[model samples]
Target: MNNKPLAERIRPEKLEDVFGQEHILGRGRILNRILKSGRITNMIFYGPPGVGKTTVANIIANMTNKRFYKLNATNASVKDVKNIIDELDTLFSVDGVLLYLDEIQNFNKKQQQSLLEFIETGKITLIASTTENPYHYIYKAILSRSTIFEFKLLNKSNIIDGLKRAIKIVESELKDKNIKIDEEALEYIANVSNGDLRKALNALEIAIFSTNLDERGIIHIDLNTAYDCTQKKILNFDKFGDNYYDILSAFQKSIRGSDPDAAIHYLARLIKAGDLISICRRLLVTASEDIGLAYPNAISIVKACVDTALQVGLPEARIPLAEATLLLSTAPKSNSVIKAIDAALYDIETKDIGDIPAYLKDAHYFGASKLGRGIGYKYPHDYDNNYIKQQYLPDNIKDVKYYIPGKNKLEEKIKSYINRLKGSEL
Candidate 1:
């Protein structure tokens, strides 16, 4: 049996063999243009894991036909970087060197700074790969010297293509073993891997290796076998890192955007990361801030879901959480309540505001009536239709309107009712 992993065994050697990231690697793309020029410069590949950052870096070095040296920033010391630079200098060739650094974000300020002179002098062409936002993690000095190419997660189609290629390679190696994989099994692996081609390939390898051939001397991988092999989908979420906030942002935005599918997807990610508190808190906020008066009952539903989730944690909690996510995502969207409150608070903080009107003050307090606190206060209940228009705001801001109803059906009804009441008072 070959000890090498399937992903490593079938790693793409040429740009054409690369399955995903067509946006950058496709014909007439920026990477293609750079490769054709045969003149490489310092560049950073920024993206999620298993998205071919290291693969692309290797391809660049191979295509350029330069002296290739690789270093993992995690364990490589500043001395190691200097040693590579010194070695490249001895080559004394015009080709220059291609230094592929993996996890460049791990390099500290001192280590990163050490590479400046070498890169600046054009003696070392840096091809760095990082699973982080380079702007936030990498030093500005290094970023300024290198062009950044963002690699996005492979889409479903791209992942499926990669899985097919892996399957073919495995079958070829097995030869007379007569291994066969159902199309649905391939799709299941693709879907569960969530756009990580390396993960999909690994899952395929596991399913094929773990399953025993039937009496017919043929190994048939079915959907159930695939699910059993790749039961736990690897979630790219860090509970204490930027991904935490990123997933939360995506969840709330999906609900606000009225996309239940996206909201549930993000919710699943949070659940998989065991972040129940964030899910409940964000859902509650979305209910009030996004749904608001558009669906006054949404807050209650979300609160119930949160309470239920807190009471019964984990697997069961997912049910209520899913309910709340779907409810808030489909509910009529509105931010009128938040907008009104923010507008009122802005005026109170920035502008000189008057006190409460005398008629609206507490008349039951001692000596309050003597000070004319309750004077001229018209009781609406005593008027015709039990309605009256009285000044609620202070004398200075009586004309100000803050609580404008939203465009949803419920808010529109409230708006009509308010208009009718005001007209009757007139």
Candidate 2:
């Protein structure tokens, strides 16, 4: 008996009823294969909101004819979850419980970890959904255990199709009221909703309630009214303490996109908000990791700016700070620095992080040269230092080459120097 209207009344109840994600739900899809074969794995549906994640889970439940239960990580707790597991044991004698956990990443590590056995032992077929990227935010062990399916946001055409479905619902619900809505206005609602089908439907519901006259009466629903009705919903980007990520995102995108003006704008925002110190540190890193060698001088200049800011203090230090940002934004960009480290890290992960070659190791200690550790070591000062083919790599990594310098002025010099030093080896 709530005052909510059409969209609420007609939420889809079956898989065939769900829209979008055709690849997953289309004929003979992998997901369909999993379900029809009775081998559906523990899954995590990850993407932006309202692209049929929940509906898919429901379809899974329906296909299996299993007991279905929903828990929101926002409200459910350890005890509550345990209670639900116990309740499933008590109520359902069917194959398994199909547990749909929404916003699963919101649960802390321990809470999430609790679900592992239930998944492993086949106590439940857990389908978790999250808007945030779980790879970054969720615990690793949990992620490794589950199959992940990424869902993308619906595009314009998909949104139009979903809107058409909503229109049918609206027409059905308000049939007795003799009310009508313009297709263009409905399309505007779909556009504003931005691929969130729930958002589009919700906006349609609100617009219906807000309009005093339907198409038969006054035929009114201007772009402003359709827009204002939904856009007024809260999007408060509370610039509280934790806005560091947001600021960093803006800075990274600006520098990567080569918009020096926007980079400066984001810098000003962080600086004004008293997060200048953090901004300065990240920029110091960005100069080397992102703009390194492309503009080798950028790192030293950024370091100088950091020192200047710290030594002289803020109120007046923003001058050098601004200068460093301008140089970094306008300078040539390269990810070679970070890419080198990342590739090295990948090697460490998949292969052994081998030790330095004996030749590369220290020979200064007693009895050291006898072990061939530094027996043939070539001190650059002993000779010309211009072209010395020293064994620098660990035995394991001797033939493994990782770092590829980006095309930049300083790296070109580095390439030439390396070529001269290791002419035969290279």
Q: What is the lDDT of every predicted structure here?
A: 0.87, 0.74
Segments in model 2 whose C-alpha atoms lie over 4 Å from true places? 1-7, 88-91, 136-145, 177-184, 232-284, 297-406, 409-426
Worst 10 residues of 2 by lDDT: 233-242
Q: Which residue pairs collide in model 1, if any? A: none
* Backbone clashes counted, model 1: 0
1-426 in candidate 2: lDDT tens per residue? 345545445557766666777777677887767777977778999876778887777777777766778899989899877876786566563567778999997899999888777877787778999877778667787788788887766776777677667666665655655335666777787776767778877776677668787556643556666776776432212344223576678886787667889988888777666666677777888898889878888888889888888788777777888888888888888888888788888888898768876777788899988888776667776667645556677677777766776787777778887777767322
Error of 1 at 314 (Å): 1.7
Report the lDDT tens digits of candidate 1 across residue range 1-426.
578999998889998998888898899999878887887889999888888888888888788767888999999999898777777746554577889999988999999998988889888888898887888888898899999998988988988888778777887898878777898988889888977888888888888899899999888899999989885877778775556778999999999999999999999989988899989999998888999999999999889999999999999999999999999999999999999999999999998779899988889988998998988999999998788978989887888889888899999898888889887311
TM per candidate:
0.78, 0.64
Screening candidate 2 with a backbone cut-off below 3 angstroms (N, C-alpha, C), the clashing residue pairs are none
Cα RMSD (angstroms) for every candidate in the order listed: 4.5, 7.2
Report the poorest 10 consecutive residues by lDDT, candidate 1.
86-95
Relative to the unseen true structure, what is the C-alpha lDDT of residue 178 in candidate 1, on a scale of 0 to 100?
74
**Which residues of candidate 1, in runs, are more than 4 Å off?**
92-94, 167-178, 207-228, 241-243, 342-402, 413-426
Model 2, residue 86: what's the lDDT? 82
